[model samples]
Target chain A: MVNLAVKIKDLELKNPVMTASGTSGFGEELADFYDVDKLGAILLKGTTLRNRDGNPYPRMAETASGMLNAVGLQNKGIDYFIENIYPRIKDYNTPLIVNVNGSTIEEYIEVTQRVNELDKIPAIELNISCPNVKEGGMLFGTSCASAETVTREVRKAYSKTLIVKLSPNVTDIAEIARAVESEGADSVSLVNTFLGMAIDAEKRIPLLSTITGGLSGPAIKPIALRMVWQVSRAVKIPVIGMGGIMNATDAIEFFLAGATAIQVGTAIFRDPFTPLQIIDGLEDYLNRHQIDDICKLVGALKY
Target chain B: MPSNRIRMKKNVGEFTIVSNSALNNTNYHICLQSDIGLPDIAPGQFTNVDIPNNKDIFLRRPFSFFDVDYEKKTVSLLVKILGRGSKSLTELKVGSKLNLVYPLGRGFTIPDKNDKVLAVGGGSGVAPILQLAKTAGSSPGQMHIAIGARSAEDHISIADYLQFAQFYFTTEDGSLGEKGFVTDHPIFHDLTQYNRIYACGPLPMMKAIAARAKEAEIFCEVSLENLMACGFGVCLCCIEPTVKGNLCVCTDGPVFNIKDLKW
Candidate 1:
């Protein structure tokens, strides 16, 4: 049997497949589609200190190979996740990681502190790199000092495994990954949606509520793979790779390049059963390659 | 709430188009039939029609339940050619298969037996309102439907719903039954008679009806046509800020009482 298990510091994932935050809001939406526990881990939607109204309507626009969304982190705050969402998903066998976001360092710490109290939650993905939000999302992720400060502060209160999801809208992603890693970030996932936008020529207006949005789907997959490869080489910690990963073959590319784990986003919207299918496909791929343990596939790329 | 949901099952079902014909200058009537029997659909519920063979339009387009023939295993959509997806849906040939996420979102509240209901449909909004009036089982006198379009040629033939509702028509150019908007019709002069007001259409049209419904103190529900990608609740793209909170237009409702809406 090919073992699909992977480790992010103290936490152990059954496989290397996890759901990207914002795409999977809690575990209930896709609960009807498949057994969500079959996933390596569930990265819950980005939660903040207080409830956010998010951006205005017509928030999404479809483009070739991908779509743009300026959903603006519309969650019911950290308290709500602890009270309402945590109870419902706590029973699931898969690891539930809460992706925490905020406008400032304390706001980030507040969300991290609250999630740390939840016993079932094994990790917190510090979202210093959401491109859609106007303030404190990609703002924290764009710079080295801010990324380090947010990571260092949250790391102090939160003793569990910490994952900093990185933004791709930067000149040097490797530098930012190194910055967060220096601040005791257990691991880093790159790249979050690349900052992108679409416009309606006839209407002379931007397609999204926020003119620019994080572009995910097959459109960003190549760029994400490149960043993951770079960040994985730069940082000593495990690098979770995501971006435009649609199926099993695409996922194997991430493992080959150097990602310890991978998160399935945007594609899940099209097919909720993709994660399980990807997990199954990984097993088949490993068996086909005659690799007994999946770890052998990590960074196994030759030239 | 899951225990009491009207829809027993929801999925990506492959349905063959029995007919896809232009009903008017701007809209097309596409009827799809699935071999695997159709699910029970409530009014205001919609189908996310995947525009086949188009990589440009990656997301499925959300179309309200225009009509349904359960015994025939068919569901209908009133697609207005506004964007690439809707335009692509019109181009599909008969016998072409289209995948749809069926019975999506919360349908309208089934009105009381004795309640007098007025269903106002404007633009593509005519579909869901007509669906409700046709299958509502309300007596002819109790089911009042008013449909409005820019011009007479823009209105689709309503022969199918003739036996179901007491119909009214309006066009901006005055080529049809009336010369003004649906609200301008004499039928809406006295809103006190309508026990419930159900509307689905352009924002301005529904907002106008919402105001009148408020004045008359009649219970009103409006279906929103928010830009949606994923029909299921996965993507929070279709969120409508309501009294309860920021609820998904695809899940919490495509149908919501005027009271629950922030609009």
Candidate 2:
């Protein structure tokens, strides 16, 4: 039998497959399609200290093999999530990780501090890297100093497993990964959608109201994999790799490239059953390769 | 209005195309037959049709539920060539099997038997309105459909609707039944006579209808179209900011009442 278990700091996942934040909202939509509890984990939507209405309409546009979105963390505050959303999803067997975000260091710290008290939530994925929002998202991620400072301050408040998701917009993602490691992040996930824009040439208007939005899907896979490889080697903590992972073959490539666990983002939109399919395929791959443990496949690249 | 028993569930199935024909320069009608029996699909509900021929469009293109023959297990769609994804779909031949995620989003409320209703449509938005005319169980006192296009050549024949509704037509050029837009047509001017209004069209047209419906104190529900990835609520990109909060157009509604809408 093939074992697909993996760990990041003190947290242990049943497998190395998870759904990315914002892509899978509270893990409820697909309840009719599949049993979401079967997956490794579910990263909830990005929540702020207060309510966020998000951006204006025309916030999304389709591209070749990908899409662009500027849905600026449009969730009812953490309180609404706890009162309305939490009780519903709390009973699922898998861990529910809250994706905490804000416009300032204090907001991030405060949100995480509150989430740390929720027993059902095993981890908080600190999102100092959302590109769609106007302020304090990618601003903290692109710069090593700011990234380190935010991680350091938030570390003081949150006691649970804290995974800092990194942005690929940085010049040297490895440097930013190293900085977060120094500030005591349990694990790091990369790469959130790359900043991109599309314009209707004839109409002379931008596709998204935000003008520039975060691009996700297969179009950004190669870049995400390269960054994940670099950051994985640079940091001691596990690196959660994502970007354009459509199926199992794509995810296995991430494991070979050193993503201890991989998150499925844009692919979820295409098929709600993809994550479960990947988990089954991952086991099939292990059986074919005669690898008894899935963890052995992590960073399995030959020198 | 239907009772609270409305549990709008969706299904994923493969459908075989029986015919594909152009209705106008931008619009086409494709008929599909599902081998297994079909489910109960309401007007304003939609199907996410997969364009397998195009490598670029990895996502499915959503079209409002055009018509469905439950006995024959055949469903139809009114597709308009809008972008690369839809352009590829219109080029597909008959007998091509397309994957469909069906009966998605909530449908429009069925009106009461004694109510006078105005159903407005524009461009490719005529499909769902036609379905409502055919299937809205309540036999309303009177129903009128006003469909608009750019020119007389752009207007498709809707003779099938004659039995269910008294229909009107308009074109930008004075070649069809009327000269101006649907709102400029006579039915909209007599909005006070109608008890309810249902519309689906371009954003500007629906917004204008919503404004008039509000002024006339008529109940209004508009089916919205947005750039959608998942026809379900997983991806929040299809959000419409309403009075309640940010609601996903895919699940909470492709159909929403005007009072609940922020527009």
> Which candidate tops lDDT?
2
Measured with C-alpha atoms, the lDDT of residue B82 in candidate 1 is 96
The candidate that achieves the highest DockQ relative to the unseen native structure: 1
DockQ each: 0.49, 0.45
Residue pairs clashing, model 1: none
Score candidate 2 by lDDT: 0.88
The DockQ-derived docking category for candidate 2 is acceptable
Candidate 2 residue lDDT tens string, A134-193 = 889989999999999999999999888999999999899999999999999999999999
Interface RMSD list for the candidates: 2.7, 3.2
Between which residue pairs do clashes occur in model 2? Answer: none
lDDT of 1 by residue, A74-102 (tens): 88899887888888889999999999999
TM-score for each predicted model, relative to the true structure = 0.94, 0.94
